[model samples]
Target: MCRLALKTANEPFSPYEVLQAMEAMKEGYDGSGLGLLLRGMEFEDFKYNPRFPILSGIAHSRKAEQRMDEYMDDRGYELKYDHRFAMNPEKMSGKMRYRYFLRAYRMPPAFKDRPQEEREEEMLRTRLDLRRIGEENNGDLTVFSFYPDVAMIKEVGWPMEIGEALCLWDGQIKSRVCMAQGRQNTNYGINLYACHPFFIQGIATMTNGENTAFVPIRDWLLGKNIPGYIGYQSDSEVFAHILHYTLRQLKLPLQAYKHIITPLSSRELETHPQGDFLRGLREVCRRLIIDGPNAVIGTLPDETCMLVMDQKKMRPATVGGRDGAWAIASELCGVDAMVPDRDPAFDFQPMREHTVIIPPDRKELQIWSQHDQLPLPQAA
Candidate 1:
């Protein structure tokens, strides 16, 4: 599968640009599916109602649409803005079963003054309830993401073709950080839910290789008894969940993710300063250790974008950009397409021992080493 992520330090960029990057790496994907996750959005409605949570997905029928409206109304959610993409029937098969939607809703009256944590909990419950309803009704309605400043769209088609079908090139929903994946159907049977760039809470991730250790990782996540840890349609979904679990649930730093997923060997740990802590964490998170060939690209809540590789480092990945924009992709060609004028000397491929992390500020491109707590040389 091909994966690409773009993050602008200041100005919001179009998700179409990310699709362009993925399109450049067409050799790595078979065009089975395309998934896009846009965060820190700049839509007109969002600018006015920046605090409202956006519920994005597809409604398969008029009945499904009505059901969603009724459900939200019953829950006291005020519909602030309802924007539906006018899909091109000719571009997106005439028989397409669903219409894309990005609806922003004001919170229930009672949640208006509630703590942020409490409000977030209720939103998660609402999203899960809607998801369950969709599943029960044969996917009459499907919600990909329900959070503030985030929106997702996915379908089965070539990355750029799907973008055109969704009318994303119109540039209505631009974002500071956007991630797109051109999927190569392997074992998932071409399900939309199985598409990459999976998200949970505010964290999102897309992967390029198989997760041979998916079953155990999924089991461990489910065993955590988290409210939103139910979907396992894609093996790579676990990566996003793991990120949420590590950062939100476990309250660990972002750097700890590389350590948790690909911990240092015993001999290497021996020479490390936090060897004891690393040892304990390795044991505790053994099941979460990713096995098999894989490369991950993800974005945190703060719009910090990161790229990490499995211990084997089998998949191709690269990071490149200038002062205001940076991008990570599964291949050098993808990065080249995103930022063609970037200095080749600054563009680097992260190894199994490092994580390429670019904060929202875009002031520095940090290459963090898994073997040490300190950061390696950074882009100037």
Candidate 2:
């Protein structure tokens, strides 16, 4: 079931009123309801623009340039200069340049009997301004000579929605934790709607394996097994289930605090079919849950796990302690850095010691191939 909340410009048109209007439209058109409703509302005055937000200012600039070039090409006019509309001598060699110079420079000799060269130079200068105006207004059929609004849409409007959607969709993955943190001040606020089950499952399947764990979560909500307490059962309930499952898999023992620490980080999400980080995290979590907390060893095949040193607890030699103690973080840098040194006890090793795996699908490869493990070919 779909539950929609509408925010209208006026208070009198409540969300329920919008829903009723939608229902009426649906009744009027039968199966073609949504399309008919949209058609009816297409010309209505709405606060929000119906168009999808533009994503790149460069795209707009490129499109404008293409249109201008096409217009010039159709008119048999060669674009021989920069955006400012000045003629380029390089593009027009000896004969072409001379012809163009004659056309541009030749003027009535009655004004002043100037030398051919000097008159040509003066005429060229006079035509430069007019040529600039013509170039600037090329391909423009509207009363407004240039699409300044298009430029503004590209420069300011496009990136806003696109970036917001990106940040929202990407920030919830467990592996993208660092990147998501970096985007917290900007489009991250849209994480509310972006962290839905559809997005989560999409991220999970992005790496190496099918998102089997998320399937159950989806089933629990929409497959006639939903709990009565869930007032509005929808995709959001699936999100809650997956969040709970992730926390449980992580072995975070606090049931009361489930709400506080359920959502996985964007870093942990495996969107690519062969993303090692996603696969590794999933495997680690699966192993931990299956074999109990002590089964961290031998779970990650061909991978060296790092034991994070808890700075707050000030523990020096322990492998596991806090919630995120066993998880791998960035490598230690300075001599005085708090992170533990790579040792056999902690199962930590540099990339040089490990054999990297490359999945058959090229798109699943990580940005950095540090975690890739080459799979052996199956027997025929």
| Local distance difference test, each candidate | 0.83, 0.21
User: Per-candidate TM vs. native?
Assistant: 0.95, 0.17
Q: Please report how far candidate 2 places residue 19 from its true position, in Å.
A: 45
Clashes of each: 0, 27
Record all residue pairs in model 1 with backbone atoms less than 3 Å apart, i.e. clashing: none
Residue 258 lDDT, candidate 2, scale 0-100: 16
Query: Tens digits of per-residue lDDT for model 2 on 1-380?
Result: 11111111111211122223223222111111010000001111222221211011111234444553454344333222221112333332221111111000113333245554453334333323233433466412111111000100000111123223223123121110110000111211232122211111111100101122343445443454422212221222233333334433343312211111121234533454335434455444332111101100000111112111111212121121112212121211211121123232433322211211112121121111223332312320
Off by over 4 Å in 2: 1-208, 213-216, 223-240, 245-344, 348-380
Which candidate ranks first by TM-score, i.e. highest?
A: 1
Per-residue lDDT of model 1, residues 155-219, tens digit only: 88888777777778887778888888888888778788888788887889999899989999999
TM-score computed on alpha carbons, candidate 1: 0.95
